[model samples]
Target: MIRSASQGMREGRPLSSSQAPLNVVGEEAQSRPGSGQPAGTTQLLLLVSLAHLISHVYILALPPLFPFLRDRLQVGFVELGLALTVFNVVSAVAQAPIGFLVDRIGARRVLAAGLGLGGLALLSIGLVGTYPWLLFGAALTGLANAAFHPADYALLSAGIPKTQLGRAFSLHTFAGYLGTAIAPAVLIGLALLGGPGLALGVVGLAGVLLVGLILPMRVPAAQDGADARRRPAGSPTAAGGSIVTPAIVSLTVFFTLLSFSTGAIQNFSVAALVGGYGITLAQANAVLTAFLMLSAFGVLVGGFLADRTRRHGDVAAVAFALTALLTLLVAVADLGPVVLMAVMGAAGFLSGVIAPSRDMMVQAAAPPGGSGRVFGIVSTGFNIGGALGPLLFGWILDHEAPRWVFGAAVGFMVLTVVVALRDRWLAQRNSGAGTRGG
Candidate 1:
């Protein structure tokens, strides 16, 4: 259960028998942002979001430097590509196990350790500058990458006020998108100023520095500790039934489809526009950039919408249906440049709108004290989609079938709509059954 106003606490101070119990007013005063809460909820939110931003920065860091790395390290493109494949594969394999670790030990420590490990990996790559060392660094970074989703979601679930969760989640996601958007320029600029070595070194140091903020954070208790204190020994969660229910499996599919659909637009839209429609490269890139920026803005708007309505399924369904139509139009029609940009931007915004509600749906599926395991397992869909989408879309582009990119995206979006609605229905049915049983 979520902490109510009466359950709120002062910064760094847990309730003790020696102290008087807090009144609702007193607890609210301590818990509310900027009201003398220890470490402050607002501060924790920003710190966590900043960590998310840096994680994405590291994810995209090497991609922008591939050309520089090729020349500097004297390696072929295949070798560099292998580094990325290793990174994604290792991360995909490790996320779920690490999630269980988060639940068992705690999220903050795991998150801090990941940051430290990732930082050391990058620092090693910069200092060593060998292809084998690069592969080693990539593998270590992958292990570090596996830790973020599980730890970050667990932290947010435990720390943020229930009422404010939607907005908090949106901001967190927005920071990540912002990181990806900036990484190319950040890497290019750093490489140009000094070298790729300098760029990697600086980024690595940034991660190490951020650890300072995380270590001293006097945040609220994590769900693991709270659950141990609050639950009776014989509770369902204590009995340990499997967390991988049908609902969890369905949500995983939903995430995979969502990632694949969005990855198509993100990775291939510019290429498709140029190849299929005779658009200039500049025009295609402009459209893609607009799409990405508008998507980030839409996440903020969706946060407000998520807070306002409990029907996240309806929101996701309607948004996805419209997105599919727009994608199909893009597939079949050759619109003017301005019109194409506008339509793609709209599609991006709708896609972004689905994000917070998507997280909310996952949150709902997560049993208390099991958020880490649930998110760890479901978020692996991202890696699956990321790995597979590129292969399939790159093949279509290679085969000179550009319009099929949009067509495939439309198919994925339609499937997502069905899954979203079905998940919602199942959740409602379970909730109703539980209420009657009670």
Candidate 2:
């Protein structure tokens, strides 16, 4: 029973065959129960993945280029380290406001601005020669990096079905990691071909140009935006969104600890191997590659697992425990480079499992139409921890001992476990009341 658009021309007119199936599927998709994704979600995922890849292309390139940056600018360890530290600090703090902007303006504009501006910031880092000017460039880089999540995650929340979020997040994380993993190997060789500084500068130029090209690209329409404007005033995702419920607030604390832990791993792992374990920089970087490669794999697999998982939080908790044990093991164990690399690989694998599940948890908890702001706020934890972890760990390595770095990381893990246990207990209490969503 379908009414064709052309049926008005004549009641006797035969209906086009294509109209029948289109009506059936469209009606079925619209009628399906629950908060589900749109058909456009798959394309959005591709675009998001590409955006992540581009963003991380810069990230992966940065660590290896630190040597070049140091020599070219004639700066010391403190200066170079501070540049990165400040970058993350600025980037982390800005996410909340950026999130707010995305909520009002839309993801299309924010996404375009972040990537496009990020490209400009990077290009300046290359063109600028003075130490003070270079620091300015780093600040700009931070701002550019800070702008991506709110818009990207918001699009994801509205377009994709809640159940499929794990896979989407995993794809996002994996794409970024893949970009990071490729940077050192590819860019380093390119740097060798010309000059390191020249290579980096050229790469940045390409990124800027690419962003300019991409910003003008077309995007699909989002129904969520229209729906939000039509909703009653004082929705949870509006004013009520600001207040995190007790359990949700607790989860935020857990996210903060997780952020801190990731920061320690990302920032210090290379330096620790070099300074504490007596490994050379090249050797340490090689080990870092292992860590990132496995981490990339972990993100992809974690997403897959999360998508299939009936109990995502439990799976996340188990993953967290493994990461904790791995951190502790790294702290206490003394091993050769080969053995250490193997261990890091295992640690990376286990740690990778939590990312997708964690992202899903946040998405699930976010008040409707508030994904942009929530992602923005939560993402700050990652960047802020990025700032703190290194400064804290580097101080220990430079002054006291390398062992302290892992010990501090262990503290973060312990906090994570406590939070996870608390969440489980609350879930159990709620379960008996027949309030558990599952």
Candidate 3:
């Protein structure tokens, strides 16, 4: 039973009724039997991470097939582009609603269904080979894409031990990064073996096979549909608190700023280097590739730091601040090829270091049983930033101002730092308030 504030104070338990429920739930969550057996926890992480990887693979998979698609479908670039635009738009709009569904039904079932749906969409597109079918498949895949972050985070939070969550989160992110890095090569290789259809079919089949592997295995009790329904009324598990809290809203903004800053560099750095510095295309690409590879390695290192520290905001803020300085240096300084690669790679490393800390902050803000919707809401920021980033930076390039690409990225990073610090301050205040007696 949740005591009133006055009663709690008299009993020397100072938590408000609202706060007490979460504390109780947290204890229950941590103490649940079989929650952290190493083998089971590792299996859960592997499946979830692989699902995330496939989700990212699908995101970039189609672009490599564009040439084949254009030839086979006899479509113009505009139509093909519209398919991608539709994908992003649908994914962004559906994420929040899908998240709500995740909290209601259970992440495990939703995740399997999402993966199966996405695979079928890809396979159908490959088999059909028509423009309208392509559009439909793109939209369907977008909806499936919406489910990944919410479901993955929900499962990880409920299934993994609290002590090891940072590393799990980092590994999950690294898998997504790996997928993006490998997608073009893998898809193109498959295309070479047969055709575009073969490439899509193969990748799609992988998702379907993964679904089979996940369906029979047990998920955390907290994420089981029957278990959620059985929870006592008035508990945090039964009545999930508000999803649109100040902390969530702020985190959403922070995600958007973070996404925009990173997207600018990822989408435009090579072009910026080539045009602004009069560098060769090969050199520019080499620098960008180094940046990307180093970033992936940095994510692993950041996981250890995330596990060791409670000051996630400070870590994120410091990393973003350093990245901003590097961006500024790229914009204004003239450097040799070796020096450029080192600086840009260092910047990417810092950016990757922010990933685990970013997830930690989001987890900190989520109430028990609310991971799905909170992560869903915040992850929408990526789509928003992705949707807007091209227009902003492409315009800068079109206007013949490549240096501004780095400059704009730097500006967004600074904004990210401010938001990170603000979130940290808010968390500190809330923590202090919760500890004080009424």
Candidate 4:
């Protein structure tokens, strides 16, 4: 049976033990973004996950669909890259505004509308023969993805039990990752048998169905809008009248850097494998799928530790360090597909673990009434990294062999590890001090 939150933690929000292996705070993490979720927290997590799944599959539509789209549009590298740049740019820029809307209007309204429109946009992509029209569809899809995170996370923090936050978030991220991961194989297969239009239509129809399902789900947004209205001034103190803070800028930086590394890999990994080692697209896609699966596992484990460990920052540091080392190994070593897959999977697992910890830390560090703002800011940074990752990798790919791109990715991983270590130390010291003062 699932356990109740430990002492000092509130209902629906369990925190890691103060002295647990990577403990930062026992219950403090859960309480940071105050939750008054109705009794149906599990159901709430499912709804949140489902909402994300619909939008994420749409965002990830590019990967497997790329081969088909390239053939149909007869696009060159320059054109393909430009379309991607626009898509990522629009999405990155939209995160902050979308989060602001979430803060103002509540997540349910924003997310529902975004998902429905995004679903339509996905269908439109299948029909749009013009490059500009395709780009327009991509922008709409990005907008839908942007709408999901802020409100979804706020709802999760409010509704899900703290101890399960990691698992919940793992499931949350996996929703997107899963859709993205499965997309290549499924879409490719569909294309082989049915053609791009049919494949795209099926994918779009799936999103529409999900949106229809969620429309009737009736998610209550108690933690976000209602709370903001009730405490218009916001919570000024912790339980004992101490200041409540949420980590904002620093978490954003970490998330952005991490995303940069991942995005670089996403954009260039196929080319690198095919050009550098002469691997087939199917093989390359397999490697990516393995990597994503490991990442999902990493997230689940990381979330579990987030609620169990006392020193979360250090744990994050360790996770990033592992990712860096794996990246370096992947870059310089002339390993076969098996070894390469193993290392890549392990790297994804370790690095991916940072998701829940990062989210939890940022929410906890926010000053009163700023959760939406901070979440938005961090999300924008993440999308920015996503936007830049491809462009940067593409530049390197244009100038140098695939090895150079791998080296650049290694550099990103190293930088992220250093930043994560710094974050860990700061979170521990500040949280520890907070405990003593309280």
Q: Name the best candidate (by TM-score).
A: 1
For model 3, the stretches where C-alpha displacement exceeds 4 angstroms are 1-39, 226-232, 235-237, 434-437
TM-score of 4: 0.81
Clashes of each: 1, 1, 0, 21
Greater TM-score among 1 and 4 belongs to 1
Displacement of residue 356 (Cα, Å) in model 3 is 0.7
Ranking by TM-score: 1, 3, 2, 4
Order the candidate numbers by lDDT, best to worst.
3, 1, 2, 4
Q: Which portions of model 1 miss their true places by more than 4 Å?
A: 1-39, 223-226, 434-438
* Candidate 2, superposed: residue stretches over 4 Å from native: 1-39, 60-63, 209-224, 239-249, 274-284, 427-438
Q: Rate the local accuracy (lDDT) of all candidates.
A: 0.83, 0.69, 0.84, 0.68
lDDT of 2 by residue, 64-87 (tens): 777777788888867877777667
Q: How accurate locally is residue 203 in candidate 3, as Cα lDDT from 0 to 100?
A: 92
Q: Which candidate model has the greater TM-score, 3 or 4?
A: 3
What would the per-residue lDDT of candidate 4 be over residues 1-438, giving only the tens digit for each residue? 534434312342323222111111122222224543334455667878877776666766666667777888888656765666677777778877776676566666676777777778867877776667788887887777777787677656555655666678778887767767667677778778877777777777876776665555434333335434333232442222322223566677777887878877766787887777666788876777677789877887887888786566677777877787887787788888887888888888987787777777766665433455457778887787886677788787787578777678778777777776777677679879999999
Report lDDT (Cα) of residue 30, candidate 1.
Answer: 43
Kindly indicate the candidate among 1 and 2 with the higher lDDT: 1
lDDT (C-alpha) at residue 11 in model 3: 53
Between prediction 2 and prediction 4, which has the larger lDDT? 2
